[model samples]
Target: MHRNHELYEYLMKNSWQMTEDWYKQVDDPDPNSLYSTTDEHIINTLKEQNQDYFKRLHKIFIEQEEVFLKEFEEWTIELAKDQKHLDTAVHYVVREFNKTQEVYISYLQKFYKENQDKVKLEQFFLWLEIVRKTFQLSIYIYMEEAQKNTSKQIAAQKEMINELSSPVIMLQNNVGLLPLIGDIDTARAKLILENTLTQCASLDVQYLCIDLSGVAIIDTMVAHEIFQLINALKLLGITSTLSGIRPEIAQTAIQLGLDFNSVRTTASLANSLAAFNQ
Candidate 1:
């Protein structure tokens, strides 16, 4: 209806005022939340962001639904990736979003009340539905983007942990020590193989001693990967020494018919070090 444009203009004028009112009414108790931030700069940024959201929301009255939603999604993604928002609890963010939607609905109700006779009841209901639907869509988009950002951060952390866990400690000239611990899954074994080869080359190490005293268990696939690493090291012209081959692991190697003739074997890490010094 023609009144749609009138309502849009009305909301547009009150955009910054709405932000101020909503912020004043915000009652966040959690100190960890973005809403609870006391920094003047952060508060100003939050207000600006809220005003920006209102600007985008009001555009629905004039813009095509598809176009509006696309721009809304862009705004959602930017807010979702914001470090401050990311640091805040997701539930708190959603709570604030719902609160903001309530504020918008109240404003719409006020506008409808002011022109109760001119705007039909059905038109008022339609406008309310649009506001609610748009807010719901924004929330859905925000959650998805936040989840994706979290996944990427976790993957990066895992990579750092993997690199740290599989360190190739340089012992002396052209020699390094790799002490593996805990269970060796196929995935970790593969990481070790790749990481070790790269480190050996970078450090210009001609010899590597791999100690397995801390390793409690390894599956068949992991054992195969370890052997594959040794073979890889051979191709790189690096000699490899295996130490602390637990009886269980030794049995697995024998059962698998693994050929250990190509690499040096030692009873313990100390023995390997002694051999290296000889």
Candidate 2:
């Protein structure tokens, strides 16, 4: 513990230089990195964060060596859950964090070289163990938190796409137009059903014209989902018309044994809109 305090005192006094060197490396980073594009405010915030960390770290290392990991935990979690860091690419952050680790190891080596008489072998091991464990734990939490944030962003994007793809435009009083384009998969088909119904209710649509002119093909299940969507609309008291269903989709609907005889359909969007006037 005596040697631990000796190393700690040395590090406490040199923490500012160590932190400054870490930031110097982080500033220029890799050429293709997000760090290169980061704003000045964020850079300043990062510097302040590092300064706070070093203050806490120095005190813990010198006064309560056994509690270093616990003392460092809040700082680790703050970095992990931080929106700015989470928004940056994971690989870029990892590269910079590894560089910071290198800075520490180098600082320790420099310390040993200048003060060989003050350092013991076991003291070196204690320093190494604490640095390695604390930083590794921080890295693990950072990666896990970033992955979770990414997953949430992806899910939110998919939902926005679904809402955008299925749109109901009001053509007249109590009438709406829904134009569906692209290939229909099970997931997309489900979105179409949900969004169309919600839009109809929101628009107070009594009749809806569904145009599928851009759809080239759809599987059997997708066809069934569309047919089911028509029936569902009927329950909501909305008159639904289908148009521009390609021949392949028709065949697939037939193969699925779907009964659409009662559902209204037209050859094109023009014809469907014309039928509305009559």
Best by TM-score: 1
Per-residue C-alpha lDDT of model 1 across residues 114-209, encoded as one tens digit per residue: 999888999999988888888898899889999999889889988898888999999886789999988778888999999999999999988899
Each model's C-alpha lDDT?
0.88, 0.78
Best by lDDT: 1
The estimated TM-scores of all candidates read 0.90, 0.84
Candidate 2 lDDT by residue in tens digits, 1-278: 53356666777788778878988876655555556757788677777777676667556456664576676775776676677676677887887778777877787778777877877767767777777766677678778877877788899998898889889999886778999888779999998999888888898988889898888887767877888888889999988899887787788778877676887999889888888878
Model 2 lowest lDDT segment of ten = 26-35
| Regions of candidate 2 where Cα sits further than 4 Å from its true position | 1-12, 27-32, 53-74, 81-84, 111-118, 255-258
Please give the TM-score that candidate 1 achieves against the real structure. 0.90
State the TM-score for model 2.
0.84
